[model samples]
Target: MKKKFILLSGLATSLLLSGCWDINEAQRMYYVDGLGIDYKDGQYEIYLQLINFTNVAKSEYPNPQTVPAEVGQAKGKTLEEALFKLFRSIDQKVFWGHMTFIIFSEEALKDKNALSIIDTVLRYRETRYQIWTYCTQDSIKDILLLTPILNKSLISSKLSTPLDTDDQETFVEPVNFRNLVIGLNEPNHEIGIPYVTINKNWETAEQQGQDTTFIGVGVLSKSGFKGLIKNDAARGMQWMHNRTHRGEITFKLDGDETDFLTVTLEKIKVDIEPLVKNNQVTFEVVVKLNATLNGLKTNVSEDEIRKKIIKEVKKEIRTTYKEALAKDIDIYRLSEHLYRKNVKVWKRLEKDGKIPLTPSSISKLEIDVNQVNSGRKTFTGTFND
Candidate 1:
């Protein structure tokens, strides 16, 4: 009985001891916060922002100041090769589960191997599918090296928190790795990635002074980079996609272009209907918005102002549609809507190589603006004093 008991104890001890053999210390692992990819001359450059958890965990109250992250880079012919090279050179093993976002340069998306790079990254077990993706026209190195000045944190809160904002201040809708892949696999295979840029004064000498700005939407067709829609057109793209939540519109109060009144959008609803007749495709877009009078730079009737706002909204939608048509890109995904609603008509059009929407295809657009709040009542001539 004593010998049997001794043998059981020895087996239990071995099992516990074996579990500790592969254990890794938390301090020995590098946690990545963000990743940036750039491609040039058939070479892939990978940039990683490593978070400093020690500083983040420090017990500092109210206005704690500490360096939050550091940047590292490695280059090779493919993403896996570049990542392996990066891991081999670093002293600590890199952990990507904490990675918050990924940015691809315009040049990187233009490469033929861009899809392969995305596949390689997604295949890794360490990377999360929820990481937000972006495309930038600026240098990927500059964007990766940017330090948050106002936020004064290790990671740039502006880049990380944009998707969570309740306001429509952000023009383009953010796409995650999983949705991007799903969109690419769809029948139309149309997707748009938000565009980012750095705004800085070259004359300024401060290191953490520059600000990152989201400028436009980068359109991708059939899993390839197509083009960009910038400025108000970007906002228009959001309107067409039914992604606008809360935004502001500035328009001339009357006939004077210099006099402007800004209205804050409280709510918006968009309806798109696709119709086919005589072998021709046309889309009708109707936009309805509820707004409040936020600014009044000139004295004008509220009724006239509401009319002007509606006209401006319609114009923006038309301009955005024309721009997309000119590039032969469908930012609105009307083709997908047609396929889902009327597959037979879509198939007939597809057989004729007309699955995508064109400029002349969008025949009608309508916009209605309702002023839900006019602010404090205004009296003319001080009550006849």
Candidate 2:
């Protein structure tokens, strides 16, 4: 009788546990991979790109191209409100658990209260803090539509992502939402985000016989869109942030001033020190880099080339750092470092009104770059030849 009672009770408990909590299957709903937000004329618009499962499945040797997923937009007074408006149109319950990318319009970012708008999305239990956030001067809708030609060429490729770990240094510095928040919450630090501009380069690439295209970058300070950082300035930002994981660096070759020697950054490290004097504040930025002799027009020995490389690399680092500081933007988080290192000093400066220490204060700066390694010799069949 005792055994029978115990078995019956266990069975009842098992039946109650078999509820809908664990039954949500992959096929039951749409998975969103990216979300775009824009603010215009006192209204908010939200964009969602949900993955199409049918296109994701079926792996034949020569499969047909997958159709691009549709984009959904909702508009309202706030981000969540706008998203909810779009949710009403979808059939399956839309799930953002898999979502990893969010783009904000430059205008949206300028609003002093922009944090409140983003808070709803970030505070959601289902949303991941690692989602990459981008700021663009162009319309968020326009930016979304400007997919890379190569990515669109392949049916299986994604248009936008959290941050492509492989090409992080060159194209865009993907800032996850959590990192941005931390930088913002820090007392003395201000946050910087990548600003993108879209053009007809996608179609131009196909017409001009090229597989890839260039997207321009805009700079953003605490005060909305500061200005555009075209070509070198944009690339310089990557160098300053120590985000140049792998990219070409060009300089005049030894004994051949007209010819160019291009070196590729193999590794890099950035360190910073903030010094607060009696009244003036100065920052020391140290960048250590390693590169290989990727290309050269002259036959200078490896050792000779390495010497010239160090001299040129330092000049490049300082020039870039100065230009960024001129814009009053600390693409490098010097303020954040000062806050962590000595909060008391920073507070003292602020209290005495001796230092103009606003969240957006421009830093007085210095830069130092050391080249650790130039190139390697392969022993198998090559030796200084």
Per-residue lDDT tens digits of candidate 2, residues 312-364?
65665555546666765555555556666767776666422123433223343
- The TM-score obtained by model 1 is 0.88
Q: Pick the lDDT winner.
A: 1
In candidate 2, list every pair of residues with a backbone clash. Answer: none
- Residue-wise C-alpha lDDT for candidate 1, range 1-385, written one tens digit per residue: 9999999999999888756668778888988878899987779888988877775454232144555667778999888788888888789878888787899988888887778777887888988788888898898778777755553454445566566564756466778888788777774676788898997753345453786778787776554788888887766775665567777777876577687778787567888888888887788888888877775554567678678778877777778878777877777777777878888888887732238566677778887775546776451212332
Q: Scored by CA lDDT, what does every candidate get?
A: 0.74, 0.59
- Residue 156, candidate 1: Cα error in Å is 5.2
Candidate 1 lDDT (Cα, 0 to 1): 0.74
Error of 2 at 5 (Å): 8.5
